[model samples]
Target: MQQGSQKIYFFLAMTAVLWGGNPVAVKGMLGEMSPTMIVLLRFLGISMILLFFMFYKYGKAALPPRKHVPTLILMGFTGVGLNNGLQFTGLQYSSAVNCSLVAALSPAVTAVLAVVFLHEKLKLRQWLGILISFLGVIYLIAHGSLEVIKNLSFNRGDILFLASQISWAIYSVLGRGVMEDLSPMATTAWAGVAGTFFMVIAVLYQGTGVTFQLSNFAWLSMAYMIIGSGILAFNWWNEGVSSVGPNRTAIFSNVIPVAGMILSVAFLQEHIGWREIVGGLWIITGVYLATRRSSMEPQTT
Candidate 1:
């Protein structure tokens, strides 16, 4: 493999680690911070971090082009705003296990959405990979109990997590266009600034007070969400979509559930059944099939 390809895969894998831990962090913040506050603070903190770096590098041109301003704002709304908002809120009602399990849908969701909106095509293997991965998610979450999946007692939180995945899928597809000129960090920075603007407005409108007396763990959790997941993972994801295309890059998202499940088992003491092992294999196989070097070339516009 070429050096560039290695870097791209590395970024995607690290992004998975960050993204996977996001729900566990959110699970920690459930009682300490309101969902809106978490979203507001996360974006605000990341935007500030990104701005400092951009200003040092480009000075006044840290501001994006005027024509790109609106698109950036919309991207922020969907990507950071709606996506994080739904996720944090949903995490309040759902277990971290459920949230991560549901997030496993993101890759397939992104692929289908890309085909519909971005006019991207998938090789047959990639499509099959997506299907198999989805089935794995079902089996793992349902613990191999088909009746549970058949009856599918999805609560508000599960539905919201699904929405969050859709929001992110749209964000991922939209990112390909935006990255035409901007680097991954630059793109995440500007959209984050735009997204933070709207989040602040909503926070104020809702009269949510910022609580300062958080424990050390809560602070650390928020920091992870801001720096690790919000900033780094996003930049990595943008790079993946830009260089490898969404379908191949999104396959890495399968790692999120696996990571979240492990962490949840350790930290949250969530129980796991035999189905996790079986379902996880299906997901791994699907990712391997979907991301084979021969077919994983970047799609053209």
Candidate 2:
């Protein structure tokens, strides 16, 4: 690979690594903070810094046109607001391992959504990949037990994580439309502003009193989310999308579940068994097959 391509790959891999720890970090902070509060604070901090950077780089151009504002807001609502809100809340009822396992389905969901909304063509291999991934999700959700499925005993957090993944897929599709008229930085920064706005509303409507009596570890986790995953990962992911398109960038997410499981086990002392291993392998394999470009397909980068 060329030097420039190497740098993009490095950043993309690091972004995946950062996001791999995301669920574990959120799990750590849940004891000290409500999910909504954590979402509010994280995006609030990220928005401020990113918006300032956008303004610094582009001046008034950082802000989208008035007509484009609504799309950006919607993007924020789905991607940042609903995505993190649901995921963090779900983490309360689910293990970080489960959270990462569900999240591994993101690219598959995005691919299917692209077919419906963007009118993109799906190859036979991609369709098979999606099916295999869906099966993996079912296996994980059912805990590899027929009784869990028959009795309808499902982990609430996993269900919520699935919802969050759908929300993020919608956000990814919607962002393509907005990016036609704006730079990725502008889209990401303004989306952060809009997401932060929606999160503030969610916090107020939930009517829970915010508390700051958090331990040092909670503070550290919050900082990591705000800076590492929120800002850096988001930016780097967008940069990768801009550089090599979403398909290539998304394949990097295959690293997340692996990293998440390890971190969850190491830091949170969570257990992972055959179910997570098998399901996660299926998911990672499916995502790879679904997103990888064929030799006959034209390359953009």
| TM-score top scorer | 2
TM-score of 2: 0.96
Q: Report how far residue 180 has shifted in candidate 1, in Å.
A: 0.8
RMSD of 1: 3.4
Q: What residue pairs clash in candidate 1, if any at all?
A: none
The C-alpha local distance difference test score for the whole of candidate 2 amounts to 0.89
Model 1: per-residue lDDT, tens digit, 1-301? 4789789999899898888888888888878888889988988899899999899999997777787778888889998889889988998777787777767767677778989998878899889987887777666556678787789864667678779888988887887787777777888888888889889888999899978899999999989988898778877887787787766785687688778888888888877666566776776677556555473364541
Please state the error at residue 159 of candidate 1 in Å.
Answer: 1.7
The numbered model that scores best in lDDT is 2
Deviation from native of the Cα of residue 190 in model 2, angstroms: 1.3
Candidate 2 C-alpha lDDT tens digits along 169-253: 9998998888889877778778888998898898899896888888999999999998998788988888887787776777789
